[model samples]
Target: MRATTTPALFTRPRNVAASVAAAALALTLVPGSASAQQADTEPVDVRLKVADAAPVEVATTPQAWPGELLEAYGVSVDGNDLVDVVRDGDEVSGERKRLRQGDVVRLTDVVKERKTKRERVRRGTVEVFTTELKPGVRKVVREGRPGTRVVVARKTFHNGEPVKYRVIKRKLVKDPRPRRVLVGREAYAVAGANGLNWGALANCESGGNPDAVNPAGYYGLYQFDLGTWRSVGGSGLPTSASAGEQTYRAKLLYKQRGRSPWPTCGRLL
Candidate 1:
């Protein structure tokens, strides 16, 4: 029998595939490897500001949406709230942009409030023409009173600061009272009567008595009848008018009828 001793056969382990995979993973984790470089690019640090609150530092991955980042930080947003990106102390763009290192995300709270207030309405002046005084003379008969109005407005605010205001409705609470004034319409100077002796005529007509009255329905210093008084632009009873007013109407009458209206008191001037 051949004492043939077979040489010892060396066989590879069945775990060769596992060992190769482990070696490949180790190479990828080494410095400057593709996996190591990819890890370094993640976990970006950014600043987040919400309304008037203080800014906070947050960590996120590159190219991550700002909405997702906010969700991760447990922040909420409303439909009216404003979101924006800031860089170098200036706004960059909308909030839908991806996250970047050293970027700031700002959230502004928008609010609208309805307000009601009362305001004053200024009064106006009204003029009433009369012949009680000389022309160009004015007298206040009634004082004016201001009115009130209710105003309803919508005020908009951003982060507790007022931004816009608009008036939505207005209602008059009280009507304004107009000021009433009496203005004179008699001419300052009556033609052809300036050189005449008005005092003599008045004394001869009613003895210079402004309140004089006659049984023939004549009254005042000029003894004017109601028909003649109104023809000379006189208002109310001539006896109720002032002495100067009575004289003015008499002068106007003289300019028209040449003292013919005062038949008994004629030729006194």
Candidate 2:
């Protein structure tokens, strides 16, 4: 026999009342099914915990429930992008959300970055300055070797597509080998005279006439024969050269073989 008693479950929540007893709990627990249908629970209040941590201050204190800066802008927190938990790279529908410190922002839109690497650079030429050769004359006495260097380049991409490449940094890995060059310069003069009177010798030889020639066919102020003049780096006849050149040759000749070449005139000097 079914009991004819009315069970009161109006004071409790629907879920709590459901577990009370299968014999009495329903949309309403009135005496008749007709009375239960007319009397129904409407606009009931329920509480649920959402995922993601909120401010510890809000949970511990009697403060207003989860609120954000967006509340001043009149926005609701129900699945709103602003109030939801956001990571560094977490995005929704191709739109970016707020990022936390630990979030890694993955930029899939346009990736433009510079990656530097060490590579074998082509050999380079080194310039070695030399005083052994003349100013404008260049001569490489030693061969040069190529050197290595470091080059940095940047790669640009757009929408996961490659666009361009450019060099960003350049550094020398190995220094270039230098070439040795020989150059020419003016010869240094001998410091002091060796007690020989060049003026006296010239005066005695041809009366100081650098262009003088003897009747015997000997040439110059110092009376140089072909054989002797050629030995002292004098081309052609000594008389054909300038006074300074003739004197210089005579001085050189004197240094080598002494006054013996002059003979009679040598005694006068």
Separate clash counts for every candidate:
0, 9
What is candidate 2's TM-score against the reference? 0.30
Task: Tell me the tens digit of each residue's lDDT in model 2 across 1-269.
Answer: 01111343211222222322332223243333332433432321111112121111101111112231112111123321223332433443222333222322121223467788766644444454344666547676777666777888988754346777999889987876755555543232111333567778889988988888898978888989999999978998898898877877887787788789988889865
For all predictions, the C-alpha RMSD in Å is: 22.7, 25.4
Model 1, span 204-226: residue lDDT tens:
98888999999989898988889
Q: lDDT (0-100) at residue 201 of candidate 2?
A: 88
The TM-score that candidate 1 achieves is: 0.49
* Candidate 1 deviant stretches above 4 angstroms: 1-41, 94-96, 135-137, 185-269
Clashing pairs for predicted structure model 2, backbone only: 88-103, 123-147, 132-183, 132-184, 133-182, 133-183, 133-184, 134-184, 149-173
Worst 10 residues of 2 by lDDT: 55-64
Among the numbered candidates, top lDDT falls to 1
Model 1 root mean square deviation, Cα atoms: 22.7
- By TM-score, the best candidate is 1
